[model samples]
Target: MKIEAHEVERRVETFKAAVQEAGLKLTHQRLEVFRELASSADHPDAHGIYDSVKHRLPTVSLDTVYRTLRTLSDLGLINMLGTAGESIRFDANTRKHHHFVCVNCGLVRDFENEELSALQVQEDLVGFGRVLETQIEVRGICNDCRNKS
Candidate 1:
């Protein structure tokens, strides 16, 4: 889940552009929040992000972080994973991929399978509307946690 330095710069620029396109000012708080997310492989919740950003920008509030995350998600700058138990995690990689969530440790890692990515969901299958995106979450014990047992 480690992002290359070049990729991190690219992501930040892309996110900034998206925000500008949405008629929003690229505030300092938003930039710091984006940088924290761009540098983390571990998907973090709003509080986690706020905590990290607060180290550098001590005046930042948790509410501002939450609102910034929501804005980024709304603009498709990042992905909001609200299904990972009660905590909502945020992912910087918006590309097509799935997640393998460790039930014991609550670790979420990206998993990309060509077959899964190419899957086409028929609307009749679920009697639902069109599928804009597809993400599969597999819950199980991670190797690290299993080894500790």
Candidate 2:
């Protein structure tokens, strides 16, 4: 998905509004972190985010990036993909969509399908209570990895 400039601006604005609604302090670091996430198509971890933000704000620390990401995740502004065993990843596309995780390089990419979105949960599966969310992660080698092999 090609994220346009206006779309990034819109997401950033929405993020700002959410921060205000959550009564969280709005800092330049937070905005920069959000912008970096908003503009990224690759699901990035805290370290990746820290690397990106540090290019613009050299004084920014990894801890600041983590805290900003935590605050945004807590506010429901972003989706935290904890299932990534190697490293926790974050998705800016909060919409209902699945993921394609490349097993070779651990790359995460978004995937969307009407049928997947329309799936109905059985609710009685293992007595896990009501299912509030559903996300499918298809693990396999990506085109790049396949070509390399």
Query: In model 1, how many backbone clashes occur?
Result: 0
Alpha carbon lDDT of residue 106, candidate 1?
Answer: 86
lDDT per residue (tens digit) for residues 28-125 in model 2: 88888989998988888999989888989999899889988987898898988876356778888877899998889887888789898888888776
Give the worst 10-residue stretch by lDDT in candidate 1: 122-131
Candidate 1 similarity to native, TM-score:
0.89
Per-residue lDDT over 1-149 for candidate 1, one digit per residue giving the tens place of the 0 to 100 score: 46789878888988888888889889898899998998787889999999889999888899989988998888888998876347788988776889998989888888789898887877564766677867788999999999999
Q: Per the 3 Å backbone cut-off, how many clashing residue pairs does candidate 2 have?
A: 0
